[model samples]
Target: MKAYLDIETSSDGRITVVGMYRPSKDLKQLVLPNITSQEILDFLNDAEAIVTYNGDRFDLPVIYKHLGLDLMGCFKSLDLMYDCWEHNLYGGLKKVEKKLGIHRDLPDMNGYDAVKLWSKYETRSDRKALEVLLKYNEEDVLNLCILEELLKAKKVED
Candidate 1:
């Protein structure tokens, strides 16, 4: 099975949430203080391939540095950013996503906002901030699936 993944990190590089979405499964967000490295591994244990926008450079390395889990070493990785580059598309995930007409529920959201949200939740014990952060991550992981399908259809058409 393919796993679509994204991660949200604090400005200081601490991981606040690990968002993982597998097709036909509920979106899972492993929030801080409640997550173990093994739990993250177990969630990804059955994945034969991993799909992400710029995972090779950002997500995968972060996962490795933080959790010491070499997911790329364990599973095949398909970085959609490279696919976009081949199609003459450029920029980060949200930019490429917009170029391809992929819809997002939280368009105004970005990595900076994610960090701020985490800060709010962490410092003030704000549940609403955490909820919004989770929802933002949910959109990020789920949209990756849509983006991959669209890219595949484009490949077939060309």
Candidate 2:
């Protein structure tokens, strides 16, 4: 099985949420401080490979830093950002999404907005902010799956 993963973090590197997507399965968003490392490991157990945009440098490291789960070399991974670079595609996920005509409900939201949403939840106890952040994260992980399909198709053509 293949899984797509993404994470949202606070300014100080605290992981606020971790999102995962698998085809034919419900998308998952694990809210931090309430989530367990074993839960994540269990979810990842059947995944033969994980796909992410910049996961090698960011998501995986943050997961290890916060959850004490070092998945860097243990699992097979496809970093879409690196794959894009090798294929001469530049820019971040949003940019690539736009170029590929990938549509999002919250097209205006980005990583910085995720931080703000977390801050709003932390400072004002805004559940709505957290909800929106989870929605954004869900979209991110889902998009990774879409991008992985596109990349794999492109590889076949090449």
Candidate 3:
């Protein structure tokens, strides 16, 4: 089974939320300071592979920095961004999504927006901001799944 993962962090690098998408399961968001590290690990342990965009350089490092868990070799990783580079495809996740015609609910949302939403939640206890951030995160992971499928189909065709 594959797990699609994404994380949202504060400016100082504290993780605010971690989202996971697995087949046949509802998208799960672990809200930091409320959820335990062990809980996150338990969820990840079930997956044979983890899928993400730029995860090797960004998401995985941030997860290790905050959780103190070295995920290297824990499971096979499918880094879509790295695959794109290998094929000479350039641009970040959003740009690649556009190139592939993968639609997202919030086209303007980005990591900075996630940070701002986190800040709003932190300062004023804004539930809506947190909800929006979770939604953004959910889309991120789901889109990774879409991209993975596309890549797999292309590989088969080749």
Candidate 4:
């Protein structure tokens, strides 16, 4: 099975796992405090392939830093960023939308925005930031699935 994951991390290294999705299934929100390093390892162990929007550059590295787990050697990881970058398309997450032909009304929120969101949450104790962060993370993981479908179709064409 394929598992799609996206993470939101604070500048100080706290991670909130946003979402996980499998084929024929809707995305699910995972409680951040309930996650552990071993659980991530277990998910990587079970998944035949893993998909993410910008996982290689950001998500996986952050997870490795926080959890002391390096997934580089463990699973088949597909990073949409690398594929886009290979074509000289440096545009980050929005590239996924254009490449996959998916429409989402997400604001121009990126990881930097996530950092700012956490900052606001910490400084002002604003719960809305947390909710926005979760929604941002959820879109990221779901976008992975959409990109995967586009990739598979291109492979067939090739």
Q: Quote each prediction's TM-score.
A: 0.96, 0.94, 0.93, 0.78
Sequence-dependent TM-score of model 2 = 0.94
Model 2, residue 96: displacement in angstroms?
A: 0.7
Please report, in order, the local distance difference test score of every candidate based on alpha carbons.
0.89, 0.86, 0.85, 0.72
Better of 2 and 3 by lDDT: 2
Q: What lDDT tens digits, residue by residue, belong to model 3 across residues 85-142? A: 7655689888888887889999889999999999999999999999999999998989
**lDDT for model 2:** 0.86
Worst 10 residues of 2 by lDDT: 20-29
lDDT of 1: 0.89
- Model 1 Cα shift for residue 150 (angstroms): 0.5
Q: For candidate 2, give the lDDT of residue 27.
A: 83
Score candidate 4 by TM-score against the native. 0.78
List where candidate 3 sits over 4 angstroms from the true fold.
none
Winner by lDDT: 1
Model 2: pairs clashing at backbone N, Cα or C within 3 Å: none
- Residue pairs of candidate 3 with colliding backbone atoms: none
lDDT of model 4, residue 153: 71
lDDT of 2 by residue, 5-89 (tens): 9999998989999898877577878887866788777788878888889899999988888888887666898889998887677
